[model samples]
Target: MIITESLDNKPAAVTLEPLPDGTTWLYLRKNAKQVEADTGDETPDAKPWQCETAIGKLGADRSGETADTINAKFDDWWTYAAAWAEDEPMPTVQEQINAIYDTLAVMMGV
Candidate 1:
């Protein structure tokens, strides 16, 4: 199953693949355009910046789980994984300017 979801308000592609062992693997890829540009992979199925983790085996009882239920579970796991990944948020404009100023100050031996 492949779905597009918002992570931190940014579009991300999430994929769920079932393994032979009954466990499922979940993958998340963000910024398709940037990833394609950076990797020079323009294929339609190109997966860049993809991260994956195994979701425990789905018991027989869960075989009839609805799409919404699966999505909810994925969201919960993804949220925790995202937090654990500790991806740095983009710096604000003011922060960028301060960084530049700090660099210049050091360059000029201030």
Candidate 2:
């Protein structure tokens, strides 16, 4: 099942997949607009980050679990992921400069 949800006020696609081990996996793909706004990527087809959350045995059994229970589990994972993404640190200016320099050197026949 795939549903549309919000992450950090941005639209995201959430997919629910059942694993062979009876566990569930939820995949999230954030909107491209959010990616462009966050990374300044101007590519017409730039792809955003795809994150996955594993629903262990406790949250599995789609047939047995009620809709509310599944929704709650998904909501919890989504909230946690959003918080984690917000807390992630960006590269320092020096680090970015060094990375650019490295890329340029390789491009110019390193």
Q: Lowest lDDT 10-mer window, candidate 1?
A: 1-10
Candidate 1 global CA lDDT score = 0.50
The reply for model 2, stretches above 4 Å from the true place, is 1-10, 15-73, 85-88
Put down candidate 2 lDDT per residue, 1-110, tens digits, no spaces.
23343234433344455677775555544332433324355555554443333322224545355435545566665564444432246699999999999999999989
Summarize candidate 1's per-residue lDDT along 1-110 as a digit string, tens digits: 23333222233344555667654444545334323323355556544442333223344444554445556676665564455431366599999999999999999999
lDDT of 1 at 52: 38
Tell me the TM-score of each prediction against the true structure.
0.31, 0.30
Assess the local accuracy of residue 60 in candidate 2 as a C-alpha lDDT between 0 and 100: 55
Tally clashing residue pairs in candidate 2.
Answer: 0
* Cα displacement (Å) at residue 39, model 2: 18
The 0-to-1 C-alpha lDDT of every candidate, in the order given, reads 0.50, 0.50
Segments of candidate 1 deviating more than 4 angstroms = 1-12, 35-75, 83-110
Per-residue lDDT of 101 in model 2: 99
- Global local distance difference test of model 2: 0.50
